[model samples]
Target chain A: MESKPPDIQLRRLDDYRWEVPQTGKMRTRGLIYATWDMLPDIRTDQSIQQVANVATLPGIEGASLAMPDIHWGYGFPIGGVAAFNLTEGVISPGGVGYDINCGVRLLRSNLLRQEAEPILEDLVDALFRNIPSGLGSRRKDLKLTTPALRQVLRLGAAWAVKNGFGTADDLLHIEAGGQIPGADADLVSDKALDRGRDQLGTLGSGNHFVEVGYVQEIFDEAIARAFGLFPQQITVIIHTGSRGLGHQVCDDYIKIMMKAAAKYNIELPDRQLCCAPITSPEGEQYLAAMAAAANFAFTNRQLITHWVRESFEQVWPAGPRALGLELVYDVAHNIAKIETHTINQVTKKVCVHRKGATRAFAPHHPEVPEAYREVGQPVLIPGDMGRYSYVLVGTPQAMVETFGSTCHGAGRLLSRHQALKAAKGRSILQELAAKGIVVRGASRGTIAEEIPEAYKDVDNVVEVVQGAGISRKVAKLHPLGVIKG
Target chain B: MVNNSDPPKSKSGYRQLAHTADLGFRLYGESLADIFVNAAHALYGVMTDRRRIRGLECREVVVEAPDSGALLVEWLNQLLYLFDTTGFLGREVEVQEITSQRLQARLRGEPLDEERHQLNTGIKAATYHNLEVKETAAGWQATIILDI
Candidate 1:
């Protein structure tokens, strides 16, 4: 209710970290991982106050944490991470964001940039055409019956593989094998189902996009080799989520949680932070429904991957295997996963909420795919369409200090209105074209709103996390073409 | 003093508000019914070009919530569901009866014709972030943040 920013003191923990000491009703301290230079921009918004607000949540295991890419968000600041005790903690839909399991999936192609340069425009067009994008984007031909849609909610990417969208082996590189256990279709409301029914393969509007890029640099050769990424190698990144289904799920449950918060006597500082105890019926149901929506997102990405592969085939006339179109890895940025972590020297299972953050499990973790077990989980951080995105690997430091979490993407520096005003007469498409990147969007308005100036330089965000030892950079990707929805 | 016999019809309208990451709108009206109608209008206005849309058909919408705030969220989400499922965009919404607990209305618009109307953005859902409806000296006012 207060528009004025809260006056809070930040004690410098190090060059890359800051701390807000436990005070008042806060159950723990608030920790933010960002450089001193970043703090100036970060402090301009109320996200720091939000970090402190989150510390007041009951059963919060570690300090309420924020990654370097932190920015103002509804309940939790974007890039916020918090782990809560399973029995005593609460689940807030806002923590996972409205786009449940909104994530990134990368595909490695053996084709070098030189090999694809001639066909870059054709490839971009093919992708833009094959993959439905923009507002109200849907696949008219891929309509699913209610039962089939339920199976998608239950089986996730495996359902897509079974339906010939992709191969079963592709599932190995996906987080949680692309299917989270305990997802119950029965928990998903009919309205949620109806909303997602035709949206399975769509690249919905706003920041969602499909990028065709090439590995421009490599920081860790060993890890890069493991990920099948090499300098000059082509790759495709699909960024989307559960579409309308996830939105409705969060919307529906937020109302329930608002009531549940009152019913459970959980005092919410902000109404958007509405939540319930993890063991309560309301919490359990929300988790079940959220998992279902997450599965839908997984399947949605898998189907889009198939289309991306098809687009490549159409352009090259070479089989996918020959082109070496292998899935590198997929990571969900918005999600709540029950994971085991050591807290106070005790291995305890807790629900880790990552809103605008990614899981960066350390090397040798059981959850990391077998191929990547020797290294760490591959974390994808997509930047604005005009700039370079990074590939990072998890570290033990991340596991111990931040519950194995890292920044999701470049945090916004300018609001949409500001971006639009800045881009009043300039041609955004031309600006990107000058940078050797071909771009397409549903409308010019979205393009103007997403100008590169609207976001913080992702390079700085990545540098802060790497400097803090939360995640190690693996590779950098330069976009050759982009399709925005 | 202004004439009290005919109070100038308080303009019912809405305007987009600046948000760092998502979309926000502020709506105001002379009465609760006017604000509800304007809210629907503003939502559709953000999604597509309302000028291109014609009121070719109508559908009844009925929803109930525990309070006015939740009712507003439910009302907009219901419209989103209709758009996602049946491609129905509300060119005009007439509120027949509205209370804190219940809302009954008729939404008049044709199914989305991509060729005729240009969509601006896909709104996921109306959020509860600072969602509030209050009576002010001028009239009724509500602010909604949308997750785009």
Candidate 2:
């Protein structure tokens, strides 16, 4: 075990929370929502200081927040959250991450554990075949014309449905109804568009996965019914994002934003935090481009969803009716959305950037689907390959503390190289199979790097969020099979 | 000048050179006239065998970077981007000019004679993590990291 680093100043607020105070160069306090047990693990990361650095960003409204799953990433910590005042605040690409609108969506099926168990292998193989998973994997079927692709960027999931991927009703459960306003595909560069063109309907590698699982436990009976989840019922989770297209979009803009920051004279302590004012010409261009990439991701997932249903149809004949697959809710983990919040009891509109964070708007928010209006928004948290994933709901407390954000996953405890090194002697797939999980991937090294031992105990993370009441649990899921790139 | 190792001499006023993965080299000529001319060759060394890359004949290609870092990332990313987007791997490369502001660069390359990029795992773009290009005591030093 590596000894914890001594540099970060961690203070205990209670048994379940820790805080990195407003020390030097900090505009606001650095808040970490981890318990004492997680402290040693947290100490191993420089991301704690990154939280403090993010607090120093101009026009930052709330405290720079790190959830229990906090881990080091390129710019913002993987599980970091922050809300900036729209009028004076700034927007950074680091805050939204390179994968624009990378997110998780849950689909429920009527088949229970026993019914799905017999054909699980066939179903898993079907899913693996239908969706391309690997580095630079592209779909041969869905090539978009320039105008058609631009329209997809403008409409997002709505476009996916309009093009007959899924029904319009599926959009109701999606955050922002599947289309975030003001996404300008024209803002995306040709390189970004070119990279994105071939990647649609594919799952790009490195932490992107599609898991077949079942509801292991139900915490809220009523909410569970509303979410279409039940104990022992099988479910499928799709975890992916905007693919290379999103990455290229971010790359193209990081340069644009840097120059824009200089042109506007925006002082940046870290160039990774380099950004234009939210209302500036440079910032506007980025927002437009970012939204365009986000839309591409929505369409990508939408196309994948159609293939998933097709996969079930290949084996089960009547197209998932005999299997009973239905949509639950899809939520984005990396995105910046304009929202209204009550700051000092006055409603103010602000842009909330969630990087490796999930949005948790409370029940009855105009954006949530009508069916779930009373149960709140469904917050899907995918833990890791070996352990349990969760289905959560947005809460009133979430709006109060975190601008309605929650942890995204079981954060990494080791880098891919470190994990691969540790996994050198072990057969990760065999180990997972021993634990009753059937695993498949493009390469053995991919399995090694994504082994379950490389992460924190997600139960600890879920406890923190539940204790914080930012998001409440609905059901827990255990993975049966996983496919990765 | 003191007898210390320095960067290369350019037609304009930038240095285009090569280093290992630890510290990537970039040349910022600020004049669009010189951007890709320096970036192309700087990236070629990482993708192909430096010896082969050094031996290539001129095949003109124009490149651009939005700013200095973007130009730096784009210049490097374009080389990797070539390997992924196109199979035209390089054996030899030479960038004749570089510009930073409007981002322009030119380069020449021969077909694949090496596959050094296989050591990496599908690096999507060169990132700006701990990146720098400064006038050091030994002339100028540039650093970059490619995100795999």
DockQ for candidate 2, C-alpha atoms = 0.13
Q: What is the TM-score of candidate 1?
A: 0.97
lDDT winner: 1
Worst 10-residue lDDT window for candidate 2 chain B reads: B14-23
In candidate 1, the residue pairs with backbone N, CA or C atoms under 3 Å apart (3 or more residues apart, or in different chains) clash, namely none
Model 1 residue A77 CA deviation (Å) reads 1.4
Q: Report how far off residue B122 is in candidate 2 (Å).
A: 3.9
* Residue A439 lDDT in candidate 1: 93
| Cα lDDT of model 2 by residue, A144-238, tens digit | 77888889889998998998898877787677777888999878887777777777889876778889899999999999999988999988888
Candidate maximizing TM-score:
1
Q: What DockQ does each listed candidate score?
A: 0.45, 0.13
Displacement of residue A155 (Cα, Å) in model 2 is 0.7
DockQ of 1: 0.45
Per-model TM-score (chain A alone): 0.99, 0.96
Off by over 4 Å in 1: B1-11
